[model samples]
Target chain A: MSRPTRTTEESIARVLPELDYSKIALSLVVMLFFAFFVSPIWTGLVTAFKTTGAVTATTPFVPVLPGTEGFTLAKWTRAIGYLSTGFVNSLAMTIPATIVSVFLGSTAAYGLTLVDWNERLQFGILILFIAGIFIPYQAVLVPLSDFWINLVPLVDILAPVWQLPFLEPDHARLLSLTITHVVYGIPLCMLLFRSYYLTLSDELVEAAKIDGATISRIYRRIILPLSKPMIGVVFIYQFTAIWNEFLFSLTLIGSSSSPAATVTLVLSGMGVDLSGIDFGFRMAGAFVAAMPTLIIYVLFAEQFARGLAEGNT
Target chain B: MAGSQDTATGSRTIGGGETDWRTRVETFSKSDFVRSFPYWFVPFSLVGMGVYGGIGWNTVISLTDYEGFDRPDYTNLDFSMYAQALSDPWVYLTAKNTLVLLIAFTTITLVLGLLLSILLDRGIRYKEKIQTIYLLPMALSFVVTAQFWLWMYNVNNGLVNAVVGVFGLGPFNWIGNPDLVLGAVIFALIWQYSGYAMVVFLAGLQAIPDDQFEAAHIDGAGVFKTYWRVIIPQLKSSSVSAAVVLMVFALKAFTFLYAMFGQYRVPKATDILATLMVREAFMLQHWAYAAAIGTILLVMALAVVAPYLWYQYGQGSL
Candidate 1:
């Protein structure tokens, strides 16, 4: 079926103007737009390699000429050194949060779909979850901060847990931020998972039930295997989201002074404090902070796009 | 055995009033709703307590004169903080900024994205690669983008100045100058999210059947006319969903501004309600006033989102 359609499309393409003037102009327009879109990233990449003196001495768009004093890795080294703690903190918070939220969200979505409950009640509950996606974090920020601050005493009460051989002092703040991400993240994850789950054939679920499969067994045997693609999409989406998050970390973990500062908070702090830092170091820090998401986007661009598109749907 | 007992009890319930309540309760316990409770209860409770509960707490705090670590006086709760906010000039200024940001950002991004999607839809080569290039920025943290743009907007030796210099424009202080700061911030935000709008529009464009385009062509309609008249009109839903998402992001532009300025007091020109709310609560310790401002921001966000939700629900896609 697709073969005949492909041939028709090819014939159409062949009959059309192969290299018309308008086509050339349109391509040029797109190229220029892409160039403008990528200029900042290009500037940051080139600037990251330039020496501090060269960064100020030359225009931002100019590349650092190799075999000259312009090029150096000193800035990268310093940035990594300064950002190491933040990198660890961010990973410690983001990984567990992403995993836990996706797990909870998937289970809830599966459960919501498996039952033959009242239609209006199900939708009302679905809206309750979906509404979280819209509630401006600002609405919850004051109480959220108060809640965390109040929990510090509880952390003290559980100090013995903190002193466990596996734990550190900063673990309290990291754990709190992780929990915050999970809480905020559940709605989005559930929305994505539920949308995917709804696409599933209800007869398959009914068959499993008739076969005496428990809810957990059906979920484990059927849904989990089919959910791989969706899990990828949601994982990438939530991972980048939690990693890129700033407000929650800034509000909950305080500042760079705190041992629990995420990479975003530290990077922002680096941008502000220009006392001895140069543009080279700042750009390097920005790139370093952005590397994980950038790598994910480069590797999984299709999944990333699908995640955004499906998220809105 | 349980099913037999249930039927027996159910029949008896129909004949006897005393057993009716107990049987109904038993049936309710065995219903799907109760059976599925284990799956959804955890997430439901977490979001309920974290999001809904926080909003409730925030609203309660807003009613009191809460500030500077003094415990809130719940006994004398009222709308005094809101009244104070109403009288404050900064509130109006930030509100104006927020509205401007919401409208300008959403409109420009939508148009630009629509244009890109249309252009790409014309069978452009290397389309996916180009789309990814455009979209790569959206994946980065706001702090990273803010820092990158801060450099790009630097008065001296920055790319913006360099490009404008060729056109004989003065090197503008994009960040420091109050008159230009809001526009500058909006432009950077557009840079980050226009790609997202483009992707959404692209999906919408792809969903348009090829027959529609051919039909328009056969009717002697030009490419521009075909899109402007038929294709674009069909994209109303796409435009709406993208616009709502963009508007919500605009309301959250506090992250970008805060990262750029690294302070609660962002420039007055660029201060939206988000920044104002944070400043009031965290910096000045005007907790109640900030909560009031947050409530107002929440209402504004809902004003933008509620219609979209309603539309989705009406479409049975909720």
Candidate 2:
């Protein structure tokens, strides 16, 4: 009944084994590396909260001084005010682009996976899509610019529609940006979805097929529902990529004016235009520009990690 | 199949061939190829036109001396742009820098990531929280990271210098010095992406069976020895995949440099083929020259990715 009168020291020893020097060393090393890894972000956080005077006066890693208007949301407000237009433009561009690309790419992946085609042909088609993922955007930049310029006339055909009350003038540029992102995004999205779709059991598709379900119907009823987790993964990955995209935005939309610029473009401009704005203000803008993706990462870290792991390998 | 064929022929004769044509049309429409056409063909064609067509057009432009605001002269074309690129010293320098960046960045990040992953795998507590902290940087845009590092590398009050100063080192111009610029850029990039490498390697590490570690331990191998011998060799595939991705990212690091300097003309010390290509085209309007450079960059990227694609293809994963 007394469990052989087990001693406290025996139980303690059972729970916590003898100390290992290597384990302790490993932990210490990891802790040090963590500090290095987080130092920039820590610095950014501190600097973003400091007053303009305190930012330059104090070390970057330190918090604001006691007497110097300790912490202010002024920088954040000012930064957001400057970036608000670009922020909206980015949302306008990123949202539709992500949805369209994901939808189309997923459908394409579904087709590739389930369609009865010649094996060589299917493999060939997949290689074609996979090749697109590796093509440096620089290779296509010149022609893409030319293509967009040529497309302006076609876009202008919608001028009457663009003149509607809710549409802004910058919507045209955003539309162009959206189209660019969608087209470029398709390959990646298709690759990711196709890989995920490949893992799904063939019996699920075959069972639906035997029940007189058309491919599209089966996709809508069964595949799409089953693909929710994958959709989430691809969505977060593409959203972050498209949101943080700079070259396409810079090359396609340019930093010409406020209304049409993406958040990355505007943030780059802020960094460049070192005029009256303080370091805190600029850092705040950078943080603001990065917020959506950061938030997505924080909330969907598992999906983000899954996406990275699956997408790469 | 026999019944359908019989019906097809019987209807062909009896219905004046009209019903047969309709039935044939219905049969063809129901074929797998036709049924799945919308799902695959539409997106495939779009990518084809956008990416392949763009590359084709860029190559055409590069063949011609297309500069300034004028339309590219398509009728007359030559290899003169490639010739010029080959002859230019700046091209050589930038190409060297690109190669250096590609190799150095990939190797170092992989090593650091490997180290981190190994440490992380060793029964660390709060593993998820620790990994998330390390990975948070990867979630940020290069624009944000560049800003953070710019401040970190600032000559006077920068965190890097501040820490170094504590060790009796003088404030150094990390961004300005030619010798330090590339290394500084590489360090910043490593800071951002080593976490990615770690995550990739961690997945690799976890996939190794625990029995392997137990076997190694039973064989009197130390922890370091077990990882070095029994564990790391199995991670070759992981390393290959990670290297391919990291190399691709290293090529695309034009965004980071662009954000850091906020200009096409970055510090000469850190100027890569990407920045140089953009500057030549957009700034100098050397469209043909830039197109040539872009083509070269594309070839370089393909060189890096081709083996990976082939491996995936060989594995029937494609």
Provide interface RMSD per model, one decimal.
3.4, 6.4
Question: Which candidate leads in lDDT?
Answer: 1
Candidate 1 runs further than 4 Å off = A1-19, A151-154, A164-168, A274-277, B1-30
Candidates' RMSD to native: 3.3, 4.4
Per-residue CA lDDT of model 2 for A1-313, tens digit only, reads: 1111123223223434744554576688988999999999889888988887778788789887545575788889998998998898899999999999999899889888876666788878888888898888889999888777664543476778677886765567678889989999998898889878888888988777767778788889998999898999999999998999988888877663647898889899884553643678878988999989988988988888777877775
Give the range of the ten consecutive residues with the poorest summed lDDT in model 1 chain A: A1-10
The digit string of per-residue lDDT tens for model 1 on A1-313 reads: 1112333233344445553656678789999998878999899889999987788898898898778888998889999998988998899889999999999999889877766677777778888888889889999998888887764443675678888785766667778889999999999999899889888899988888777666677788999899999999999999999999998888877777677789998988884554744778889999999888989999999989888987886
Per-model TM-score versus the true fold: 0.93, 0.93
Residue B187 in model 2: lDDT: 94
Task: Give the TM-score of chain B in candidate 1.
Answer: 0.92
- Computed on C-alphas against the true complex, the DockQ of each candidate is 0.55, 0.46
Q: Candidate 2, what DockQ?
A: 0.46
